[model samples]
Target: MQRKNSILRSSKRGGFAMIMAIILIVVLTTIMALTLSLTSQTTKQTSDLYLREQAVLLAKSAAELALLKVSGWNRATSGCLTSVNAVYPSTTNKIFDINVTMKYIGLGCGGSADYIPAIVTPESNGTVLMDVTVTSDPGVSTEPIRYFRRTLQKL
Candidate 1:
């Protein structure tokens, strides 16, 4: 009887060990899968953030270019320099679309009434209201990114 009882007890222990091993394997697999999923999501988020930052930088550069253009504008010309649009890099493969819109305030530039009242501020002479928009084109970017910047610059 003792021998038989020992044999039964050993068999039960082996079965329990097998079951525990299977559960442990399942838990480890789940953890690994979750980790892989998180890693992929992090990669995508990082990519998106990088693209957005690039767009913002491009917008800022476009704003500066707009300022330069306005400063060079012939003030004697009755028409205010209103809009400018160009693409960055100018390569065969275009990357970003930049659009700059300017509104002027005070004298010399068309009485300033040609600009919308909401855009022009009173007593702000020689101020160039620069609105810059930079958009990532579909040719290279995985997703479309657009950044807009408004600047008040003294000409």
Candidate 2:
């Protein structure tokens, strides 16, 4: 009788251990799945952030370039280059499209420029408003990224 009781107790303990093991495996598997999901989400967010930062930087640089063009322009000699458009790399795998438009304030660009001064005020004369827009190419970027920067420069 003693030997039989011992055997029964041992069988019960073995069954309990197997149940515990299964529970532990299920918990661990759940944790692993959650971790993988979070990791993929983080990667996608990082990629989007990087792309947006690039677009913002490109817009800023484009604004500066527009300012440079305005500074070098001789109003008396020729019409101002009111608008500029070009791809960043000018390559087949182009990633960025930058567009810049300019408006003169305070001066009458009357017939002198293809872009007439949008705002003509005595106080704002010799001032320029440059709008620069940068967009990630749809062909390359999975997520759309667009950035616009406006600069008011006194020339």
Candidate 3:
């Protein structure tokens, strides 16, 4: 009877150990899954931030380029307002593109109603309002990254 009782106690202890092991496995699996999910979310957020910054920089540069173009133009010969649309790389990929619209907002020696007659014109020197939009394609996301910059330059 003593020997039988000892065997029974041993069997019960073995069963308890198996249950503990199963619980431990479940806890570890849950932790691992949570870690993976957090990592994925962090990666996506970082990528989005980077793309946004890039678009902003591109827009700024494009605006500067537009300003140069306007300054070089002969005000007497060209129209007061001009719209220029361009795509970067000029390749099939078209990863980034910019649209620059310059509108005359001042009435000076060269400013005329032929450019923007309906809009209010400033009474001072010739001023051009440039609107630059930069667009970038993020392959992973459904929506593209876009940045807009407006600059008023005097010519």
Candidate 4:
């Protein structure tokens, strides 16, 4: 009788240990799943931030280029303000577009005033607004990363 009782008690202890091990395994698996989910979200946010930064830089560069062109504008060189130009970067895989326009002022003497010294006529000065877009292709998802920006030349 004594031996039989000892065996029964041992069996009970073993069963309890097996149940605890299973529960621990389930808990660990839950924690791992949560960690993986959070990591994925963080990675996506980082990628988006990188793309946006690139787009902004491209926009700023285009704006600066437009400003330079406008500053160099002269009636003798460009002939007229209605003329414009588009410039593209000459780098490998460089994806940016730049467009510029111009305006000028002309003097006139046809006003209601008794004797107008001069009249100011607005001529199209070459100033441009630039749009920049960036894209990143991540193979994991069906959608690709995209960023857009709009910037105008400084007066």
Candidate topping lDDT = 2
For model 4, what is the error of residue 70's alpha carbon versus the real structure, in angstroms, after optimal superposition? 3.6
- What is the TM-score of each predicted model, taking all chains together? 0.73, 0.78, 0.76, 0.54
Clashes of each: 0, 0, 0, 12
State the lDDT of candidate 1 residue by residue for 76-136, as single tens digits. 7546788889887785777788999887666445544344333355556667778888888
How should the candidates be ordered by TM-score, best one leading? 2, 3, 1, 4
User: Model 4 segments beyond 4 Å from truth?
Assistant: 1-8, 73-155
Q: Please provide, for model 3 over 76-113, each residue's C-alpha lDDT reduced to its tens digit, 9 standing for 90 to 100.
A: 76655476777766757776778998766554424333
Any residue pairs clashing in model 1, and if so which? none
Error of 3 at 22 (Å): 1.7
On TM-score, who's better, 1 or 4? 1
Candidate 1 — which residues are off by over 4 angstroms?
1-5, 8-10, 75-78, 107-113, 116-123, 138-143
When 1 and 4 are scored with lDDT, the better candidate is 1
The clash number for model 1 is 0
C-alpha lDDT of residue 123 in model 2: 67
Give the alpha-carbon lDDT of every model: 0.78, 0.79, 0.73, 0.50
Error of 3 at 123 (Å): 7.4
